[model samples]
Target: MDFYHESVLLKETIESLNIKEDGIYLDGTVGGGGHSSEILKKLGQKGLLIGLDQDIAAINKSQETLSQISDNYKLFKTNYENFEEVLDSLNIEKIDGFLLDLGVSSFQFDKGDRGFSYKVDAKLDMRMNQDSSFSAYDIVNGYSKEEISKILWDYADEKWANRIAEFIVNARKTKKITTTFELVEIIKNAIPASARRKKGHPAKKTFQALRIETNNEINILRNTLDRMIDRLRPQGRICVISFHSLEDRIVKDTFRYKFLDCICPKEAPVCVCDKEREINIITRKPITPSEEELKNNNRSHSAKLRVAEKI
Candidate 1:
C-alpha cells in the first residue's frame, strides 16, 4: 500500500517553529513526509532537516516525497525515542527547532493488513515497527485478563474495560482470539447494546488501547519529550501535534512543568529547591485545525498543537 497521510495543522506547526533559513530542524515522526516537505521548502542550501520514523514504509515513502524537495535532509529508520542517539552520532549537539506529529498515518489504519482498525478482519498485529517482536496478537492472546483490563482503562479510558477484558478471557478459552474481527465481536458482545448504540464504534477504544500498548506509544512520548527539549538551543522551539486527550495532557503538563521557575511547595518560606525554568510555553492553549482543514481531512478533527521555546 502507498504511504498516504494528510499533515494535520501543517501551517500552524511550521509557523510555530519559527523556521530559520540556515538552521537545523527535526521532524520526529516524519510520516509520509508531509510536514517535512513543507519545512524543507522554507530552508536554504545551508539548512538541514532530519527525519525519523519507526516504520520502514514511512521512511521509504518519505524519502520519495522529500527527495523531490531537496537532498540536504537526512532520514533515519528509527523511533523518535532514540533521537538523542541519532544526534550524538551525527555530532549535532543542538537543533534550532523540532516538530512531532503524534497521529498514526492514515495508511496504517486504511490498510486492512496492518490491523490498526477494528473495521479490518486481518490477523491481530498492530506493531508500528513491523520488525518489533511484540504485537497486538501477543497482547491479546498472551496477557492476563487483569493486564488487558488495565491496558484498556489506562491507555484508552474505556469505561467498559473490565467487561471487555472478561469477554476476551472467556472467548480465548474456547479458542485464541487471533483476528481483528474476532476481537471486535467480543467487544460488541461485551458492551451492552444500548451503550454501544450511544457512542461510535463499540470496538474503537479497545482497538486504540491495544495499538497503544503494542507500540508503547504513551510511555515513549513521555520519556522523549524532555530529551527533545534538552537538545533544543536557547530560543529554539519544539512543536508537538497530538491527536487524543491523553497525548495532549502529557504535552501540556510537560510544557507546564518545564516552564515553571520553582516547583517547591507554596508553604516553603525560602526557595530552597531553586528549580531553573528550561522552557517558555508558547501556546497557553493548544492550536486546533481550521474548519476548512477539518472539513477536508477528518483525521485533523482531534489534533491539538502545542509549542514551547527553550529558555
Candidate 2:
C-alpha cells in the first residue's frame, strides 16, 4: 500500500509534536502509516507509538509500513474517537503527543470500488470502516428528504441541498440510487444547467455530506477532541490537521476555550467561576500547506494544522 496515501504537512506535524526521543505518541488516523512511520522514526526503542484507524485495510498496510521502520509502533483497527478505549486496554494513561490528520486519505478517494469519489461509478459504500453497518447507500436510499437536505446544508453548506434532496427522494422511488455515478447524475440534474457550471464537481458537496453523515465524522470530532487532550502529559502537544472550515472551526474554538482562564464577562473585575487555562495555543493561526505541498497534493489545498500544548 505504498501508493495508498501521501502524508500531508509531514515536517510541520512532527515539529509541532516536539517529539522526545523516548516519548510516547499517538497517531489517531494511521492512514497507510505515513504519519505513524515518521513518528516512530523519531523515537527510541522505548518510545512507543500507538496508532488507530477504523479501516482494517489501513491497519494492515500500516503494520507493513511501520514494520520496515521499527517494531515500536502498534496499530489497532478503530477510530481515533475511541483512543481512550485503546489506551485503557493497553494500560497507557498518558502520552507525550497526539497527531490527528483529519483529512480523508487520498487512498479512499482513489479506490473506485470503495465508492468514496463521485467520479467513481461504484456501489454507494463510503464506510471508512468496512465493518460499519451504515453506508452511503443507506443514507441516500433511506433518509427522508428533509433529513438528507439537513445533512447537506449542515455538513458541507451545499446551497442546493433542498433541490438535491428532492431529486434523490423522487428518483429513489423508481429504483434505489445504488452507485456514486447514479447519485452524481441526480445531483447534476437537481442543479440548474447554469448552476452546474460552478467550479468543482457537481456532486462534491453532496458526496461530502453523505460520507460525513455515514461516518458521523463531525459529531465524533466535536465530542472527542477534549477527551484526547486531557490524556496528554504536561507539555504534551496535540496537532490536528483539518481539511475544511467546519472541522477547523471546532479546533479553533476548542483551543480558544481551553486557553481562557475565566469565562466571566470582560467587564467583571473578579474571577468568580473556577476555571483555569488548560493549554497554550501553539499556532496563533492554523498552518497552511506550503506552495510546494499544495502543488504536490491537491487534497492538501484546504488543510490547516493547529496545535496546542497542555499546561
Candidate 3:
C-alpha cells in the first residue's frame, strides 16, 4: 500500500525547530517525508536532512518525495530506537536538530493489509518492519494469559484487560486467533456491554497494546530519547510528536530531567550531584494541534509536539 501519514502539528513543529539555513537536521520518523519536505525548504544547499523509518513503505515513499528537494537528504531504513547507530554509520557527529513522530503511521492503519487497525477485518499482523519475526498474531496465539493481561493493562490502560486476556486464552485454546475480526470478537465478549456502549471501540485499546508490545514501541522510545539528546550539538533542538500518553510521558519526563539543574532534595543544604543541564524545554507544555488542524484531520487530535533545545 502507498505510504501516508498526516504530519501532526506540522507548523508548530517546524517553528519550534527554529530551522537554521545551514544546520544539520534529522527526522527520526520520516513517514511520507511531510515534515522533512518543510524542513528542507528552510535549508540552504550546504544544510543536511537525515531521515529514518523502519517501515519499507515509508522509506521508499519518503525517498521518492524528498529526492526532489535536495541530494543533501539521506534515508535510513531502521528503527528510531537506533538513532545513535544511524548517526554513527553516516559519520555524523553532532546533529543541529532532530524530530521524532512516534507511533504507527496512517498508512499502516488505513492500508488494509498491515492490520494495525481493529476497525479492519484483515489478518492479525502488526509488524512495523516486515522482517520482524514477532507480530500481533504471535502475541495473541502464543503468549500466556498472564502476559496478555499485563500487556493490555500496562500498555493500553484497558480496565477489562484481565477479562480480555482470559477470553483470548480460552478462544485460542480451541483455535489460533489469526485474524483481526477474531480478536475483535474476543475483546467485545470480554468488555461489559454497558461500558462498550460509551467508548469508541471495545477492541481499540487491546489492539493498541498488542501492537505496542509487538513493536517494543514504548521501551524503545524511552531508551532512545536520552541517547538522541546526547548526540545533539549545543543549542540544537529535538522535536518529538507523540500520539499516545505513554509516548508523550516518556518525552515529557526525559525533557524535564535533561533540563533540570538540580538533582538534589529540597532539604539538602548544598548541591551534591554535579549533573549539568543538557537541554532547555522549548515547549513548557506539549503543543497540540490547532482547532483548524483538528477540524481538517481528525488524526491530529491526539497528537502532541514536545521540543527541547540542547544546552
Candidate 4:
C-alpha cells in the first residue's frame, strides 16, 4: 500500500486559517504538502505559502506536490523552531497565518525502515530528519535506565516506565537491543500479561517516548507556539493539529496562556503582575475530525485541531 500522510482535519484546518487570497502563510510541517496544496489553492497571484520541514523526504515530496498546484510556494529544509531564520532569509517580515501539523507523519511510520510504528519490525530508527545521527537506537541502547524511564513517563505517560526501562537495561546487558522487534519483545515482556491485554499495543508508549526523544519534538513544539504567534500579523491565525494528548495539552495550554488577561490572584486587588494576553483563542475547545473522517483515517483518531488568532 502506498502510504501518504493523509492530511487530518483538512477542511477545518483550512477554514481555521481563514485564508486571505493575497496574504502570506506558512505550513510549518508541510508533510507531503497535503495541507500546503490546499493552502496553495486558496492563494491568489500575490499570495505566497512558505513551507518548512526537517525531513528532507517531506521537503522533496512537498516541493513536488505543491508544484503541481502553483509556483507561489517555497519549501525550506529546516525545523519550524528555526522558522525565524528561514523568514529572515526570504525578507518576510510577518505572515498572515501559520499552520503546524505536528508529530510524525503517516509516511514515516508506514515506510517501516524509518521505525516510527510498533507494528513494523525495522531497526529502531525514528529520526524524522533522516540526516540526523541520533535515533531511537541511541536511546534504547545508550540511555541510562532512569533517563529512559523519565522519557517514557514524561513524554508518553507510560504506566510501566520503570519496569520497561529495567527490562530494556537487563535485556541489553545480555545483548544489544538493535531492532524494533527486539525492543517490542522486551516491552511486551516487561508489561504484565493482564496489562498487555488491556488496550492498544503494549509497545506503543515506549516507542512514542523514544520517537519524541530522538526528534526532540516536545521541546520544539513547546518553544515554537509563542514565536509563531509573535510572527503573525494582526488578526492572523495560527492552527495546530496535534496527534496525541501530550501535544494537544501543549497546544491547549499555550492558547490558554495567550488568552489570559491577568494572572493576579483574586485576593489581590492591585494588578502588580503584568502578564499580557497575546492571542485570542479561536477554538474554545479543540476541533476533532468528523465521524466520516474518523472512519476513513484510523490514524487520525487522536488528532485535535486548535486555533488562535493574534491579538
Q: Give the best candidate by TM-score.
A: 1
Every candidate's CA RMSD: 0.9, 1.2, 1.2, 1.4
| Clashing residue pairs for model 2 | none
- Give one digit per residue, the lDDT tens place, for model 1 in 119-174: 87999999889999999999989999999999999988999999999999999999
The alpha-carbon deviation from the true structure for residue 171 of candidate 2, after best TM-score superposition, in angstroms, is 0.6
Clashing pairs for predicted structure model 4, backbone only: none
Per-residue alpha-carbon lDDT of candidate 2 for residues 128-165, written as tens digits (9 for 90 to 100): 99998999999999999999999999999999999999
TM-score between model 1 and native: 0.98
| lDDT minimum window of 10 residues, candidate 3 | 1-10
Give the distance in Å from residue 250's predicted Cα in candidate 2 to where it truly belongs. Answer: 0.5
Model 3 ranges with Cα > 4 A deviation: none
Index of the highest-lDDT prediction: 1
- 105-179 per-residue lDDT for model 3 (tens digits): 889998888889988889999999999988999999999999999999889899998899999999998999988
Q: Give lDDT: candidate 2, residue 123.
A: 99
List, residue by residue over 48-161, the lDDT tens digit for candidate 4. 999999988898888888889889998898989999999999999899999999857888988878888889889889998888999899999999999999999998899999
Q: Give the clash count for each candidate.
A: 0, 0, 0, 0
Whole-model lDDT, candidate 1? 0.93
Candidate 2 versus the native: TM-score?
0.97
Per-prediction TM-score: 0.98, 0.97, 0.97, 0.96
